[model samples]
Target: MPHPCALDPEQVVEHEYVGLLDPELRERIELWEEELLDAEDASAGPGNYDSYEEYEAAMGGGGPEGDELTYQHDLSIAPGWKVGGFASRHLTDPAPVVCSCGAGMRPLLTVHGREWDSGTLNWVPLEDLDVLRLPGANVPAGVYLGRGLMCVFVCPADPAHPHRLSFQ
Candidate 1:
């Protein structure tokens, strides 16, 4: 369907819309970032440990290695093109994205620069395994939106209502 103001370009106005995030989920994500940062800081240099397993063992084996909390958080919010899914608030804190009609907007589409990154390798489709080994396999499209994702939110109350755009 066409946007509400597709025919009238001037009718579409620019405004800021903040995304909403759960406090508990935000806390968990913060913890995850901290853990990753700690791991990076603890590393002496390349070949500091023979392998990831050795590094984990040296870190007391209590961080993100096979951690349920990390897995759950990562799994809940996926990266890449998607429809009707949770948005990734990796770059900023979440706030509500409200429609002009006063209805809460729902995520309709999300565009990303790449299908998956090092941290999100779990999201890669099994069918793409053969291509995954090739250079630039993760980045099928060269599109880049700063350093994060761009989500388009539509008003559930009325499809004709203008949709909002969010960059996170």
Candidate 2:
């Protein structure tokens, strides 16, 4: 499926590499990636795609109805980590109602389990399996929000102000 929020083909978006992460955090993220890959692979059953194109064709739906997607407020996953989307899971801690700068906080981005899930079938990196499985085994943060999402909030007064983490 076409990404509902995809921009026009001629639109230009710039992205800069965020500096390399600390060794410890980098290792942790690598481990999480490995876990996610394993889960996705295991969910693909016994069959295997011989090439990336085959997998893409089988998992996505950018066929003839590319423009059929309608914009809605509550989608399952937040595409491109965009802001304004609601948290997928229920909140674990809703604190930080106010930022340290004494200003209201706004959602900065949504940390998703997998880049894509079954509903969207937009771009499943690895067979688009059920990545949102139980939060067992080596969870990324030792915090399990089920298949839920984590919303990061930033201070309106100062972007540098410490951010907050709220799980849904």
Candidate 3:
């Protein structure tokens, strides 16, 4: 995939045939699918791994805390376990999960969109953001934020831009 053509925001084309995906992103996504497919066995059973080495490999080795990914820019939205998907916010951004400390946990997609504007949780790369088939959708697993928050879908003028929601 090619980087979004700097000259025109609407350059290239739509998904499938579009060349607007960022080069790094296209590459990383390609790699992630590979990793996901190669997900290895843990050391013990269920959630436990064979050893520290196996554990790290299974979870892709994280920081000193062992978090799979870094948590930043926490926001406030649906907290606790989310039962149903948020009605219309999935397209913009998932409701942010705020920690008791004041900072809101970043949206899961923001974390997925590593190059996101952490402050705003807006994905710098456009392709990975919410995409729709024009009208409505139904995500059975409960379309939600990573930490498990409700989500709603929104449609922007340019589908590439981050969708906005009334909630945080």
Q: Which one is best on lDDT? A: 1
Candidate 2 yields a Cα-based lDDT of 0.46
What is the C-alpha lDDT profile of model 2 across 75-124, one tens digit per residue?
A: 23343344554433333332435787679777777655444333343333
The TM-score measured for candidate 1 stands at 0.61
Candidate 1 per-residue lDDT over residues 62-131, each given as its tens digit: 4534443344335456666677776666677767789998998888988877666655455665656788
Task: Output the lDDT of residue 154, model 1.
Answer: 94
Best by TM-score: 1
The residue-level lDDT of candidate 2 at 19 comes to 24
Worst 10 residues of 3 by lDDT: 10-19
List of clashing residue pairs for candidate 1:
18-95, 19-94, 19-95, 20-95
Global lDDT of model 3:
0.33
TM-score of each: 0.61, 0.34, 0.18
lDDT sort, best first: 1, 2, 3
Q: Give lDDT per model, in order.
A: 0.64, 0.46, 0.33
Query: Which 10 successive residues of model 1 have the least lDDT summed?
Result: 5-14
